[model samples]
Target: MIRLLIADDSALMRKLLEGIFTAEGDFDIRTARNGNEALELVRAFDPQVVTLDVQMPGMDGLTCLSRIMIEAPRPVVMISSLTAEGAEATLEAIELGAVDFIAKPGGAVSLEIDRLRPLLVEKVRAASGARIRRTLRLTERVRHQIRGAGLASRPRPSRVSPSPVAKIGKVGMKPGSATLPGLVLIGTSTGGPAALDIVLPQLPADFPWPILVAQHLPASFTGPFAKRLNRECDLDVVEVNRPMPLKPGTIYIGKGDADVMVAPRAAGVIAMPVPAKGSYLWHPSVERMVASALDHLEASHLVGVMMTGMGNDGAEAMKRLRLTGGRTIAEAESSAIVWGMPGELVKNGGAEAVRPLEDIAETIIEMVNSCAAN
Candidate 1:
């Protein structure tokens, strides 16, 4: 049986979660009324995974999460409301080592909560097996130090500090490589937000190729995520709202509720939103985006990269891209948070190169530079 902990201040919520998990029959459940209680239960129960609410009296989710990481680190899934502030906090939790998050179906107590059973269970299961560490990076430590020191008239480092880049040796094109790639396409899910935070910031401001991203996220979350990326990264990250010519150095994030596709116009390619169809399992489906690229851009001028995610959404499409002379890269297993999507591509022979997360940005830069040279 899977060991699980449900931490929330609301008695109603705690009971509801208990009922849901109990009904599932495979989970061994434990409950906590607040963060303090949750911490105690974490030590005693030693759950494989935990579901932490965003807010609670006496100890909020963020504070509790920090404590847990310091004391007893394990997979944690945040329970958040579907609001802007909630989205921001949820993202922060993910950065703080939470595996995933679930937006409370309706605020405190809604019957709709039951509707999220599948997602909640899935996230919990995934979190239970995640790889995490209790120690913080130097930059991360400095941020907490500043906060605790009350910003005392001292030089403070940025809060969202980048992780150290792993030693990535040389990566090169295969023999008889197809035409040089001009467009860059990236597809990711699961722990992608945190992964993107690492890779995107490493690219230069003058990155030559136009880039597109298809990350699995809700409509309410992507805007804030894009804004966060724009603030932290050198590249200009913008949400795709209408059809406009793709520009170099700009990263277009597909809208969360719709499909983003590239259309060839007389002047250039324009990205437009298409209504979601049941055929696509993920909103802003990666496969849909790649299909559009295949239709409009030359195969040789396209590069597809599949990063950390939970499904094989882009595997077949990446394979097709490779077959058509486009380059493809998959995140190496060791560097992936889940290795689901990238693993799919690598398993299916779609990737020409499998690279570590720290190496992916550099690899892309090299691919673009080499393609330009060719």
Candidate 2:
């Protein structure tokens, strides 16, 4: 049986969650009215998973998550309101070790309860087996520290460059690659939602290439994230399913358990799934996406963009793009919330260019236009 602790300031919400999980069966439910009570229950119940609300009296959910992770380390799912402040705080919780989050349903009790049932249950199941840790190293400190010193913030290329375009053709193109000029592969995590908000909306509707994104998010969050992105961007943003065809001006988000890969089919471009066992530390591996794009698309036509994220998930993949004659861009540190992943790529010489979030869309569009003209 799975054990769960539901911590919320709302008695009604606590009861509703209890009913939903109880109806699902196999759950030993525990409830807490506040973060302090939740911590007490954690010591006694030792539940396998926790569903914590971000706004509670006294200690907030993020503080509770930090304490829980340090004291007894267990997977936590943050329950947040749908407001902007709530979204920002919930994202902070994820960075603090919460496995995922569920937006609190609004409106009538019946409607809210019904909408959250499936998500609450699914997150509990996913969190029950997750590996929770108390601490993670932040490696981008050196880069941030160096910038504070008056040294040139951007790394100077060892060799003097005549022009930015001079390095363009040094990476040779592969045969029979896809010829679309607007398609791009984007990888992001940690602070992705905010960064994506800054980046995606800047893309023009006529942007020719399809976008394949691998954001480190759990299953339930992906739908909401896609919906949010779709509303913000001019392009059609949707989560990719098994055998879904990739189309121009469309954005495909990788599913939680599946590694999304692109391959040319007789009918056109299709997003396919690979088994999950060998996927990198994170699910919906970025490496799988980048390598798959390299294998299937003509290198000259591919543009890989890595945004603000934790860990070095996209570094090696970006290196492969550099070797494959594809353009690679990393989010500049000043714009990145965490900067671990992109910082690693920039440090390792994997990224061809480093730019702030605002410039990524324009840079990508320029690369596509340049390749098309060539």
Residue-pair clashes per candidate: 1, 4
| RMSD list, candidates in order | 5.4, 11.7
Give one digit per residue, the lDDT tens place, for model 1 in 1-374: 98999999888888888898898899999999999999999999999899999999999999898778767888788999879999999987877777788888774365687677777777777777765633333334454577698885433212333333232212222333322226789998888887787788787776767789998888788888889788877889988867867777788888878888877666556777788778988878899999888876767768899998877887898899999988899999887777788999999999999998877887877766656555
lDDT for position 282 in model 2: 70
Misplaced by over 4 Å in model 2 are 1-52, 55-182
lDDT string, candidate 2, 1-374, tens digits? 98999999999999888999999879999999999999999999999999999999998887788778767887788898766677667755764567667778878866777976775686577667654432211212233355469665532112211113211221222445333433488898766665676577776676667789988765556666677678767789988757777777788888766678877766566787666646477767888888888777677678889987767887898788877678899998876656777988898888998997767777877787777667
Judged by whole-model lDDT over C-alpha atoms, candidate 2 comes out at 0.73
lDDT of each: 0.79, 0.73
**Candidate No. with top lDDT:** 1
- How much lDDT does candidate 1 score? 0.79
Question: Which runs in model 1 stand beyond 4 Å of their true positions?
Answer: 107-110, 133-140, 152-181
TM-score of 1: 0.88
